[model samples]
Target chain A: MAHDIDTLSGTEVSRTSMPEEKRSDHALIEATKSGDEAAFGEIMDRYRSPITNYLYRFLNDYEEAVDLAQETFVRVYFAIDRYHTQFAFSTYIYRIATNLAISEIRRRKRRRLMSLTGLFQSEEDTQVEFQPPDTRKLQDTELVEDERSQIIARAIAALPEKYRIPVILRDIEGRSYDEIAEIMQLGLGTTKSRINRGRGLLKEKLQHYL
Target chain B: MSDEDLQNNEPVSRLLGELKHVEAPSDFDFGVRARIAAGRPAEKGGFRIPVWLAYGAPLALVLAVGGYFALNSFYSVGDANVPVVALNEKANVAAPIPAPSREVVSAPPVTKPDDQLVVKKPDVVSDSNVVAVKKPIAKDKNAGGGSIDLASRVGRRFHATPQIPAKTVLDLIGAKGSFEADGWRVQSTTPNSLAERSQIQTGDVIESVNGQTVTDKSTLRSNTPLKTVRVRRDGKSVDIVIKN
Candidate 1:
């Protein structure tokens, strides 16, 4: 069934009684258009980490993830004139981030394939993985935590793009199936099935850890 | 990733229940905000001024003022006896000799800076004369057009000052997540850090530090570098050298 965004957002217009902290994302976005910079700041404050973390899971590199996340918001700010308030702001932000991540992955793949020296590199070394430069030393507890994170990250990275994207959005970021479907621009049933298949693949990789 | 969140007794969900939340760096919002503000077009008012005007007006004004002075000077040079002098700035030459006049007048020899065209228009009516007149056509590297001088920060000692490691301890506070069930694993090593110098790699399971098994958490201490570490990398036990 098609979502009646006009009806839903119209209902949200009556939410002015809510406190500043309790104001909806739609309200914040609308506020941004009327020359309210603080409203835009609030929007960034709310979504920056979620979007950054989502991109981090997708790209595996925190720096690139942060960069893309910032780019996403920059695009949002510049194009606020064109953005219709009818849609959910969360869905809009996530869709922008998802597109950026997928585009970057394709770009990196093209760059890697075009490099002459890369032809001589080992297949394992050439695999695109999220391995950020981390030099900080940790004790046992933190070490164990870090180790688990790396294993999970690697397993997710190993998943094929079709499965990896949905899996990361579902498990790591906890995005709903409907939102993932909208972001991925797929049928609702297909999104659920892919998430399930992705979970099965993740289970195989993570069986030993559990 | 809780089993309930998945809406069934799913084993994968149970295992993924402890999945770590990715925290954006504290500076994340600060950066995004700066970009947003920097990218924001100045709010459009009732009247929208063309963007080119912001830059073009000042440039046009400068050219207008410069052209006015140039034209004024060009018209003021009324003497037909004076010859135009073309000075090759790249080459050095002595004071250019003037064409002889009917009356031999003794005046102090005026020296002008290089690249300056001295159009010595001798005053026929009075003793005074214009010496070393500027042509204003620039030929030097300092000619202010499209050229950009790159200021490089290479090898300036104050700039070369080594960055203090933000990390307070030598103890690895970073990703320790690549380990197997029993031993500490090396996920990665930064290019010039102690880990890379010690020959650690992604799958290297650190078995011992200073010949002592890693079962002891105190094996790593602040500022006390380890020596003779052993790693089980690629199905073989190898000694890793740690240079302080």
Candidate 2:
């Protein structure tokens, strides 16, 4: 029975990988553009987690990041006709995600300007939703792994946009310098420099806890 | 620099690695896939209601109304200033009546056809003979032969006005809007055209034309007058001539 279960899971994994790995992003994109909604859903399912994580770091808000990630994929779905295969599909999607994040940031800034209390309201709402129970009890109850993860997320959220983006893409998303350069629309040299700088900044910011 | 320093930084790298594995919400994939499905090309496609029309319809209506008033102000002379002359050939009478510098300001009072000779000089041009005359005729013939109607002349002037030129670059990859890239350059003007004549450089970044903001190279090319181009060159704004 154990062997059968293993075989079933392995077969499922292989079945999912078969279509995705065999078909290039370009092929999926072409299919999506031609009105194959399933093709786009497949693309989204493949990249959604990384895109969401990237946006979460950029926005520092889970709900907003999720919304933006959804928006990014939606935009990608419509704009597949314009997607060129010159760069990796990952680079293309990251570029779209980054642009959306920037626009969201700008929009938040505008909203903040319109109403001073608006900024605090969003934070209050997030806290209401994501706040833990009483500190001492929470600490006692929380798993070590979960606590460590939460601390890491908070540290990431503290970094500036320029540093945070490159660091998140390089370290978190596991993207290479060339891919990062294409996504950020910066030169390779600049991309490497930014990544190094981002890491250094993150180290400096989080040195106390570590 | 040193192995000690590198070792100290290892925790940061490890933490970053841990952060990489941060699990997104369970429904994230489902939500994004749904959105992607929604954004997919409609199975049946043709010219749809423009996105801008939905957003800008109110602003467009307001502008259309304002534009009508502004145009009317430029062309409309007060009705009182219109000249009125009455010729009663049937009455066997003609008056070198003072061409009332002002036509009757009020609508004509009720009057019989024979009594319509009452040319209420400055108030109304009650011509018993002609009905529905709404324009001023040039009394000075030498100004232009056969009394060129001023209203008609203005109408022709407005009618002959050229439309603003524009071009659109669709199906672009990498770039979002028109001027999203530094190296994304466009040469819009034809050689020796009005744009060229005005010394509008081919590679110049068009910022605006006639107070209208241009967001992309296509907008700059199409909306900018070939005769006048406002461009940003070497970090300075300048207007150059382009021959139409």
Candidate 3:
């Protein structure tokens, strides 16, 4: 395993420990670009979990996160020939995932607008379809810890997207500020400000916890 | 003051660290493989409709349907100014042109080849308001009185009455509505007018002409036959049928 301390945000960009025989992402992509299924499979195995987890934090909804993550890979697989190796592969894929998440958010908004009248038409419709995820799977932690965790998730989710993306990428995923800036297509100063603003918002929301 | 923020920033860092980590479903890799296998045909730019076209097709379909109906109804202008071609009246003895009331107007039962009769009968529901007239024909001067060959325009909206000469060109534009509200409001009717004969009143609110909701005065076409005229009067709806 190799690691680099990211001074921009003062966090570590930890590389995944790869096997000796493991091919590089760009190499696998090149092979896949030439129609090699095995190479593509190797690429998929390498990044799926991180991409999925990234999306999950961004969306705050597991089902939608997973769907968008899968869509991100599908897009990558289709556009492999166009994947320039000048940029890091992780940054490239994370950019794709971020775009997919933004689109999903927009879609949810449009859906809400389209059927706003339906909300009051039925009492059953008032109830949210995606219940705050079933915490039943977890062992008995303190009620306060579970509640605090949910509050934090909600607070993070509620942050304005400009703040949310940078904050999550920096704080939760431990991504470097430069990568976050590149993934978000924003200037580094702007990215840093957004993360700070997001943390300020979370701090305000979790005032009692602090 | 979290200015030169560290990875450890009060509660935000601790909270993020403690938040649950989610992994891709176990079947995600298999799903990806299956999708790749299924989507292989697309690699060659095979059989897939371009993204723009896929979305555009439905929008185009809706517009096409809307345009067809709009154009069809547009050209199918109802005969608002329908001539009274009374089948039962004698074809020769032209009755005087009539004007009586806003609802139904009929002149005195006077017969003349050229006099316009004016009379009033009932509000609506009356065939007595029809004033039949004969179209005068001039026999050919070269031939005898028993000859044909009376000349006429190519097309005209109103048939020739004994009084007025037939028009040559089609007046594409007709009279606009006098007033319009929810639909068109009947401002006034000519004495023995087509609208008056159809039992429409000055105060009647014309809701929809034919089946379409009336927008403004521009939508009224005198050439098209009035199939169904729904009107709102004194808080009640009344439908008038004007047959040619």
Candidate 4:
């Protein structure tokens, strides 16, 4: 319900005036550690949208983003006792999400290589099952917007991983440069340079949009 | 903020910021709670050996080790089957004589008279069948009256004979085999040579050159013009004069 407001405005809205919303992330984690499950739910509510949006932009695949986002929360839930408050909770969660996304990317590359080798395999060796295809209709304007969004997503995905991550955190997710540096375990200067480089790359790829 | 901060607020950054933000699906909370309830799925695909390899590798290693020991034991038994005769090399004995399927017994060293050579057979320790050769040529003058012992080569399989010492004089004279304690034991004579033409046969021992005793080191005799050669064949002395 809270996420709908943020989605409609295309910006982060203020938290609702609920008792859990007013509690700091550390306070909520403390509560969860003290056997308060609702506190953990509130923490998820706070991070779920941002983390999902971050992962979706990074992967350019909605299903994978949602899966990774859920996994990130699951990790946080299980490892709550180990979560240190030295770094901001946002930095810690983003770091975990980044690592998961990188692993998924590498896995996709391996899968691609295996599929290439499988090209020589006989047709009978491959099991093919029929499934019904999508039959949803799209309006003309919606089709154009969808195509543009796909092109932008492709350009962002095409950037080298070093640049892509920092650029997305700064520009799309509105994470501060210092927070990006802490999440990446890189120097602030290095993080900003990568963000600039990523933007330069995206500019080249999306020249028509610019 | 650094100069990089100014670049961050540029048009491309602005364009990126204007891009539509995505929120988690409505059922995202349900999914997380479900995953928590399920605990974690067993992790997949980290350093997993294939099923075939896990079994096949150890089997191949065991087979390799077993094959090595098998071959080693087989060769050891084969070497044991053949008796190795170690000679008393100090006595200037000839190389081991090949004697198939026969055990050679070594008699005690016989006392020699001042003018005769007493060739003693070396001590024989046989593990199977036995044969005895007492002593060789007690009356041979050329041996300088000292006894030498020899080991017999004993095996069930046909063994390669001891290599004959190369006698340059005998080689030039178209003969093979060594000059023994008694005389030059003629093992073979060259075909169509002077030795063959004179009807010199194998097993014939040349006892003298014109009745003069020649020792094993007799080299100058090869250059001497052929005249008469007395040979002992089958224990009888015979004189054959060469047609020079």
lDDT of each: 0.55, 0.52, 0.56, 0.62
State the weakest 10-residue window (summed lDDT) of model 3 chain B.
Answer: B165-174
Query: Residue B128 in model 2: shift from native, Å?
Result: 51
The runs of at least 3 residues in candidate 3 whose Cα sits more than 4 Å from the true structure, single-residue gaps closed, are A1-19, A117-145, B1-10, B40-96, B99-244
Pick the winner on DockQ between candidates 2 and 3.
3
Better of 1 and 4 by lDDT: 4
lDDT of 4 by residue, B1-244 (tens): 4576556447788888877777788899999999889887323345755556755776788799999999655533422211222212221334233334332445454665664433343323223322222223224422211111122222222223222122433443345667898988888875544455566779988876555544564322111233566789889998876421
Complex DockQ per candidate: 0.19, 0.23, 0.28, 0.30
- TM-score for all predictions? 0.45, 0.43, 0.49, 0.48
Best by TM-score: 3
lDDT of 4 by residue, A113-132 (tens): 34545435554433220111
Who wins the DockQ comparison?
4
lDDT of 1 by residue, A56-171 (tens): 66766667777888888888888887887666788888888888777777666544544556435566754433222233332224223567777776677666677777877777
Per-prediction share of native contacts kept: 0.48, 0.52, 0.55, 0.63
TM-score leaderboard ranking: 3, 4, 1, 2
* Candidate order (DockQ): 4, 3, 2, 1
Model 4's DockQ score:
0.30
Is model 1 an incorrect, acceptable, medium or high docking prediction? incorrect
